[model samples]
Target: MAIKAKNLSFSYRKKKVLENLNFEIKDGEFIAILGPNGAGKTTLLKCILGLLKVEGEILVFGKDPSTCKKILEMISYVPQKSTLSTDLPITVIDVLRMNSKELNEEIIEDFELCDKMKTLFRELSGGFQQRVLIARALMKNPKMILLDEPFNGVDVLSQEKITKILEKVNATVLAVVHNINPIIHAVDRVMLLNRELIAFGKPNDVFTKENLFKAYKAEIPVVICEEGIIHPLYGDQHG
Candidate 1:
């Protein structure tokens, strides 16, 4: 298994976040986590990455993420694009060179970032910057990749390109996305979370009207496409 969370629960001070969550991710599976803001989606990812102290057990590749240093080496992470400073003076190449001794030319070409290699990180568009971050994560040659809202802010064309790049990645991937429309065809499974596991299965099975209503606490419309079923207007659930 790529990851296994058993009876997981977490709280910040007195506020409860996750509760009795349990799930398993298989090897090389691309899973998309969908939830409204403050549903503990990012917290779940952090727990898997061993960034936070949690109440239950989480195993990455059959090893504890928090205690095993080797597990950290097998993972790559791309955080939300908004978390990055666009005004930084560093170049794309500089970002890639930060942790890696040698650059992976293939990744640069694959992400279509060859031309922007010398451009300042802040000068590129949001989509290009995201690609740069993904490229940097690839430098580690990790077995698993975690992306937090990769398509949150970008043009339609950039979204398509980013989806394609993720589709071809040869690793276990768990990404947090606000909506499942763009990546409907790319991900193999869907995990709907709202401080708990609402549903988890293939996109066709889990993206149902009933499941979405439970997670979002509202009547969410589901569109049946040739690829699969998707929630067109998914976003922060506010009520």
Candidate 2:
């Protein structure tokens, strides 16, 4: 399940979102799409899903996703948990059922939806909704799971649980994440994007002081801690 992009460029009514992007994810790799807001991270995912028209080549398993329905099934995308995109009156459990009929009440309950299943999706908190979405995504038994901000608005314990489950799952993960500290160890590589490829490699190797400074456009000091791991100092922002 190799995912590769070559000279990819995209736009919205002439406003460019991504440009000349190039990268590849080998089979069974956990690659994180790291970037700030409006960085074309989500648009890149949509292009792969064929929801957006774009320029250049995007190959999933060596096939163009734009014209192929089979590639769509090979990848399952989970939107931001709190996005109020769907219509109302739908229960959290109902959304799961929409994805898979094999997902019965019993299956939903096992995923810890017994109590929250009856609640309206719009009314339920963000964390609960994310859990339901994650549960629904698992039903596909997909080879690659593309998650957009999976940790956003999720509580710490729940985030830990979800990350652990994803780590243990059979699926390879390609996620757009904001807070990289928690799951940095879990991810095999990182792709820093801002309309282009800034850096892509193992977390420690790619999140260098120079690269982070360049991508973030802020002066962040680096400190060498125990085990020789480098940590960025937030300076006035944190202290």
Candidate 3:
């Protein structure tokens, strides 16, 4: 198992954020976490990454993620684009070199960041910046990867590109995504969370109208298309 959580729970001061979250992720599985804005989706990722103190147990690769140094090294993380400093005077190559010594030129070219190697990170577009972040994470050659909103704030073209890149990554990936439309086919399973585990299964099983309504606390419209069932993008408007 890449990750296992039992009776997991978290709180901020007095209010609880996550409660009794139980799940397991197998090796090389691409799971997409779907939830509303305050659904503790990011909080759950932090717990798995060992960045937060929780009430229950979480095992990443059969060890406690919070205390195991080896587990930390085996994981790579790409935070949400909002967390990054847009004014920082860093280059694409500089970011990659910060975490890895051996430069994987292939990743740079694959992400279409080869031309921006010398450009300041702040000057690049949001889509390019996200690609650079993904490249930096890949440079670590980790066994598991955690991405928070990998496609947020990017154009449709960039979303398609990132989705394709994710499909080729040979690792267990747990990504927090705003919409499933872009990565519906790339992910192996879908996990709907709202301070609790709402539903977890294949995309066809979990992305139903009932499950989405329960997670979002509102009626979510779902449409069946030639590709598959498509759910409306859950955002602040729904909340």
Candidate 4:
């Protein structure tokens, strides 16, 4: 297994976020975390990454991130675009170079930033920046990746391209994205979180109207069509 969480729980100061969460992730698997805002999705990721103090047994390939020093270098993170500082006087390559340490031809092409290597990060669009962060994450040659809202402001075309690249990688992925339309077909399982693990299974099994209602406290309008069941989270829950 690439990752495992047992009885995982966390709190922000005194406000409880996650409560007794348990799950397992296999190697080379793509897992998408689904939840409403402030549902402890990002907090759970942070706990696994050892970014925050968490109370539970979190084993990243059987290693604790807090005690194991090299554990951190084995993973890469592509933070939300909104979390990035656009005003920073940094270049496209600068962010990649930070982790890469060494420049290579493949890096230039994979990120498609050879031309904009010198361009200011603030000047380029959001999609390009997402690619840059992904490239930077790969620099460490990690076995896993943690992405938070990776496509927040990316264009449709760019979103499509990045999805392909992520799948091509051999690393296991734990991503938190808003619109899963781009990766719905690519993911192996969906982990629904809301202070606790609501469900963890294949999208077809766990992404049901009942479970959606349990997790979001809202009914996701689903359409029965020739393609398949299309469920959308739009309407309020029936009280």
Give residue 181's error in model 4 in angstroms.
Answer: 1.1
TM-score of each: 0.94, 0.88, 0.96, 0.92
Candidate 2 error regions (>4 Å): 85-87, 104-111, 221-239
Q: Model 4 over residues 1-239: C-alpha lDDT tens digits?
A: 88888998898888889999988999999998878888887887888788777888888888888677687888888877777778999998788887778876675697688899899989988898888888888877789999998877888888888888888888999888655667877888888888999999887777788888897787676654465734444422221
The Cα RMSD in angstroms, rounded to one decimal, for candidate 3 relative to the true structure is 1.4
Q: What digit string (tens of lDDT, one per residue) describes model 2 on residues 1-239?
A: 47888999998888889999888888888888877677788998898787777799888888888888788777888987556575578987678876676765544654578888678887866677787888888777788888998878888876776777678667778888876765766788888877778899977776687787777777667766675655555522421
Ranking by TM-score: 3, 1, 4, 2
lDDT of 1 by residue, 119-216 (tens): 89998888788888888988888899999988866778888988887888889999898867778888899999999999999887887778888888
Model 3: how far residue 99 lies from native, Å? 1.6
Give me the runs in candidate 4 sitting further than 4 Å from their true place.
224-239
Q: Model 1 reaches what TM-score against the true structure?
A: 0.94
- Candidate 4 is scored at a TM of 0.92
Better of 2 and 4 by TM-score: 4
Candidate 2 versus the native: TM-score? 0.88
Steric collisions counted per model: 0, 0, 0, 0
lDDT of 3: 0.87
Better of 1 and 4 by TM-score: 1
Ranking by lDDT: 3, 1, 4, 2
